[model samples]
Target chain A: MLSYLINGISLGSVYAIIALGYTMVYGIAKMLNFAHGDVIMIGGYMAFCSSSYLGWPPIICVLFSIVVCTVLGIIIEKLAYKPLRAASSLAVLITAIGVSYFLQNAALLIWSSNPKAFPNLINLPSLQIGGTQISAVALITIAACIVIMIVLTLFTNKTKMGKAMRAVSEDKGAAQLMGINVNGTISLTFAIGSGLAAIAGVLLCTAYPTLMPTTGAMPGIKAFTAAVFGGIGSIPGAMIGGILLGIIEIFAKAYISTQLSDAIVFAVLIIVLIVKPTGLLGKKIAEKV
Target chain B: MSSILSVTDLNVHYGSIHALKGITFEVKEGEIVTLIGANGAGKSTTLNTISGLLKPTSGKVELLGESLMGCPAHKIVEKGMALCPEGRRVFSQLSVRENLEMGAYTRPSSEIEDSLSMVYEQFPRLKERSKQTAGTLSGGEQQMLAMGRALMSKPSLMMLDEPSMGLAPILVEQIFDIIKSLNKAGTTILLVEQNAQMALSIANRAYVLETGKIVISGTGEELLCDEAVRKAYLGG
Candidate 1:
């Protein structure tokens, strides 16, 4: 039972990291950004190509991958979302899906179909403490997740750029009128969110030590699910949802079965929705007439 | 003294339906100019076109003698014109403070905090609810927040669409009074209103629009006393 609990937590922590990216983007844009998940896949592969294929040092590979992912994210925003912004939501949604598929397929063409072993950056070191053995890598991921969340919270709320983002999300026209460079702010959001996803990809791939072109799809979906499970747009809520979902999955997997683990987690989401449509931490928005 | 904005023979279409029909107007610095009209009089479209939210089919939009006809909305912002859009499209999830912060997104790092404090002083009510979500405010409060958010940008020209929209009669008076006061304090305002009486009362100049055409252009008093405007809009 203890083992299952720890294992679930390790997996859940990853889900939570990926979910943060989604929550942040949605909080501002009010669109799901279907391409976001694929961006994670791109990040993972970029790391793989940089570290293993290019034979670069692990740290350099991660840094370069992050930069590349951020640039790609910004490009995606400029080309895909910005152009379609004036169109209906349906058009934008379709565009997002298109971008997702295009990235995944493009990744397939570049990275090939077979699974690649992600270099064990930390090599799965384990320690026994207080009668519980925890993998150092999992602990690092959890710590990293917490640190990223706090940093992002501070970045969004305390920094001038972040304030600009909050303003644009609140009212684009007004934000622009303030000379806030509304377009630049939104593009920055995509870049930052995608950069975070890149880090999550590295952490996730390290924990698992395997890669597939479509690996990001399932994890991405799960992260998005985590975001919605908490509250689609709340930063704290996404983190909380991710941890809770991870714990729940751990318990369910241990008591039930791994195949049913995915189903159980999704079922819990449905149940949560039935109880609170806004997710666990989501506040209901009152429409101004 | 010179035109801060000039729209000459501006034409806009909503997919082949000529919405703004060859509209022409100019706003001077330190003046509160209003465009008064009934429903669907293309008042908002004129502002949207100037602000680059909508592309005019055929027209020239010049600000400070420079062309603004082809600029995007964000670029238009950089040129020092802000639009306090109709319907108070405040980021519903963001706090009132964040909304104001967005208004200065493009400024250099040095100016952001100063602009923020300036907005706070203008609307103490916003300061009280600075941490509250903007959408949660009452209509009058939301309007104030919207106007406050726009002011945070420190624009050379500020255009507001219907500051009196959907407010209690008393609140409408308070908002217009604020507009007049802001103008007196040296903010050039281009106002649009269906409430012809209140709008014209405060406007230095007013244009009476009819179905996308500017039928009359005169001083605010001219619009208020005009037989057509008084009978059709100001309830005789």
Candidate 2:
């Protein structure tokens, strides 16, 4: 039971990180950013190529993954979303779906459909606590998620750019009038969210031990579900939602049946939606005339 | 003295409907210039175009003899201009201090403390609730926060759009007093208001806008006594 819970938490941490990318982008830019999940696939592929082809160390590979994703995020914003900023939400949503399919096909063309075994970075033995063994990778993942959450919280609260982000999220015209480089602030937000996706991609591949073009598609949808499960725009909500979803999946798989786990996870989402439309932490914002 | 802002043949359009048509005005240094007109007279449109929020169809805006064409709103602000928009658009999710910090977004980090102190001194209510979210503030308090937030940028020229809107009579009096003091402290102001009485009384010069055209322009006292202006705007 303890091992299942630990593994659940570690798995949930990756989802939480990916969900953060979705939530932050949505909060600041007010777009769903459907391609966010595919960014994880790209990040994982970059890390794999760096390690296998370039023979780079783990630290450099991680840094390279983050850098490439950050740049990709900015380019995606400039090319795909920026032009449609003034267009209807439906138009932007369609464009985002287009971007997602574009990324998937591009990966299919580049890397093919075969799954690759990910290199094991951490080889430490499992830690035995109360007769329950926890893998070293699980411990590292949970620790990294907690640390990243803290850093993100501090960055948004105690930084100038963070305040500008909040201000822009509140009112773009007013933020521009206040001398905030609204475009630059938005670009920075995409970069930060994409950078976090890189870490999530790495941690996810570590636990799953397999890589493919379609690997991130399920997790991406699940993380987005996690984002919605916890209030869509709230940060801590994503973390809680991801962990709960993970634990529920594990418990359902262990006690009930593995085949019904995904269905059960999604069913829980429906119940939460019916009970609270704004997720758990979301507050209804009245439209100003 | 010399003019700080000059607008010539400014025209603005909202799709097919022309909002501001060939309006011309200038605000000299050390002056409070007010644009008073009835609703839909394109008062707010003029300010928006000048501040780079709206694109003008055709016009020339010069600030200190430099054309303000094609400048983004943020760059216009960094050039020592700030707009306190209508209806007090404060960042409701953020704390009072954070909202004010966003105002000084273009200033150096080393000088933020000074700007915060300056704004807090002007609006003690904001200081008392510096840690509180702006959405929770009362209408009067939010208006003060909006004005205080604009002042945090320490703009040389401040433009206010309907500052007295949605405020109580006493608060209106108090806000006009703050405008007076802001002018005395060396900040040039361009004001747009439907409350012609209050707007004209405080302004050094006032322009009467009618259907996007400037019909009359003079010192504040001159417009107060003008028969057409008094009968149309003032509840005469």
Docking class of 2: medium
lDDT of 1 by residue, A92-196 (tens): 888889999999889889878888898876655597877888888888888888898899899878987776677677666656655667677778888888998
Give the CA lDDT, 0 to 100, for residue A51 in model 1.
78
Any runs in candidate 1 off by more than 4 Å, and if so which? A287-289, B109-122
Give Cα distance to truth, residue B116, candidate 1, Å.
4.9
Q: What tens-digit string does per-residue lDDT give for candidate 2 at B100-190?
A: 9888888998999998998889889999999988888888899899999999888888999999998889999999999999899999999
lDDT of 2 by residue, A40-109 (tens): 9999999899998898998899899999999999999999999998999999999999999999999999
RMSD versus native structure for model 2 = 1.4
How is the predicted docking of candidate 1 categorized under the CAPRI scheme? medium
The native-contact fractions of the candidates, in order shown, are 0.79, 0.79
Clashing pairs for model 2 are none
TM-score of chain A of 2: 0.97
